[model samples]
Target: MKQGLGTQLRHLIELLDGAVQQSYADAGLDYRPRYTPVMRALAGGQPHSVSQIAESAGISQPAATQTVALMLKEGWLVAQPGPTDARQKLLRLSAQGERLLPQLQACWRATSAAANSLDADLPYPLSETLAHAIAALEQRSFSQRIRDAKE
Candidate 1:
């Protein structure tokens, strides 16, 4: 039986993330690919709120919050109360995270090269396809499409 679109997409993510995770493990780094976006969002060494990280990282707010919590637990990030709004927290990379940047950046470069190689094998680049799909969805959400299909 063929997999559904959602299942296929999830499997694709599993394949990509699994390889990256293994590479990090092989490099003796305690890191997750999911954390990369957050790290990048804070790479400038400036503290940012969860919403800011979410927007910068192109992830949802909940995902940013969860990743931030995990990074904080691992000592990869530190958080302080917002200067103006004490109720909000601002987060930044910890010393440990800063020390890991050189290695992480190298890994990111290698990952990008690998992705480009993969894209070369395909007629259409996966990155561009994804971007186009996202744009289409933004113009008309999947839910709206589904409703239209029922009509």
Candidate 2:
């Protein structure tokens, strides 16, 4: 499985993410995947513009803009004009979004517990093995991107 390094990593990531997304959807919220990444972007303690959010989330600017508009309509996000640049708007979570923090936290805990329960004793030095795997995969991705850009 690891021999096809980059492909294996992509597959694993998609599988895990799909499981997590389904879990979130089962929790009875709208549960858009964008919500989680957007929240993570806002975690940096500064309001983000749609472009910034898109870049951080690895999504397209038009998609981010659309999602932000939907979120605003759903009362989960608030937007204000940028302090220095009136043309740009800043995005942040609204009071309703803040109130959902506990729900999000609980969902994360449940997801972790479910995954951990699958193999409590996988029988390996997890940190080193996982760290090495991650580093190797990241390097592979970087190299591939560089190669692609050169082509």
Candidate 3:
């Protein structure tokens, strides 16, 4: 049986994420690839709320919240009460997280180089394809396409 587009996309993600995760392990870094965006968002040394992290990371708020929780548990991040809203928490990198930044940045560079090489091997660059797809989706969502097909 042939796999659908969603299945294929998921398989691709598994392959990519697995390789990156392995690289992090090989580098003796106790980090998840999922944590990269959040780390980058907080790299400036300014504390930010979950909503700010989500916006800075270009991810959903729920994703930011979940990642922040994981990071806090791992001792990679610390949270303090928001200045005005006690219910809101501002997050920043812990000392351990700060110490890990250089290594993480190096890994990121290596990953980018690997990605560039992979893109060169492909006829259509995956980054460009993803950007194009996102742009199209912004104009007309997959749900709209499905409705049109149904009609």
Candidate 4:
């Protein structure tokens, strides 16, 4: 019995994330792979709202909010009242996050190199495949497929 596409995709993500998390640990950094996007978005030293972070990081607002919460708990992020919109909280990296930037950048470079190598080993590069799949989904979403199937 073969696994479903979703199961295989999820398993692959878990494997890759686990490997990267272990690498971060080995480098004495207590960082999660999922935090990378938010960190990168804040690395520019400009304060951004959760919505901005989500767009810049190509993630969902809920995911960005969750990551922001986790980062705040870890002291990696700080939120200040938005200059123009007092109601909106603008998020930025804390001093600790700034200090960790160098180490994080090093890890990012190594991880990118490793991913490139992995891609070279594969017949079709994972990145390109994922991009194409995303594009295809955008053209015809899974929800539409289910709706079509029901009829």
Instruction: Compute each candidate's TM-score over C-alphas.
Output: 0.97, 0.59, 0.97, 0.97
Q: For candidate 1, lDDT tens digit of each residue in 1-151?
A: 9999999999999999999999899889999999999999999989999999999999999999999999999999999999988999999999999999989998999999999999999999999999999999999999999999999
User: Candidate 3, TM-score vs. the true structure?
Assistant: 0.97
Candidates' RMSD to native: 0.9, 5.1, 0.9, 0.9
Superposition-based RMSD of candidate 2 using all C-alpha atoms, in angstroms? 5.1
What is candidate 1's local distance difference test score?
Answer: 0.95
Residue range 1-151, candidate 3, lDDT tens digits: 9999899999999999999999999999999999999999999999999999999999999998899999999999999999999888999999999999999999999999999999999999999999999999999999999999999
Residue range 112-138, candidate 4, lDDT tens digits: 999999999999999899899999999
Clashing pairs in 3: none
Q: Please, what is the whole-model Cα lDDT of each candidate in the order they appear?
A: 0.95, 0.79, 0.96, 0.96
- Which residue pairs in candidate 4 collide? none
- Could you tell which candidate, 2 or 3, scores higher by TM-score? 3
Superposition error at 36 for model 1 (Å)? 0.6
lDDT of 4: 0.96
Cα misplacement distance, residue 71 of candidate 3 (Å): 0.9
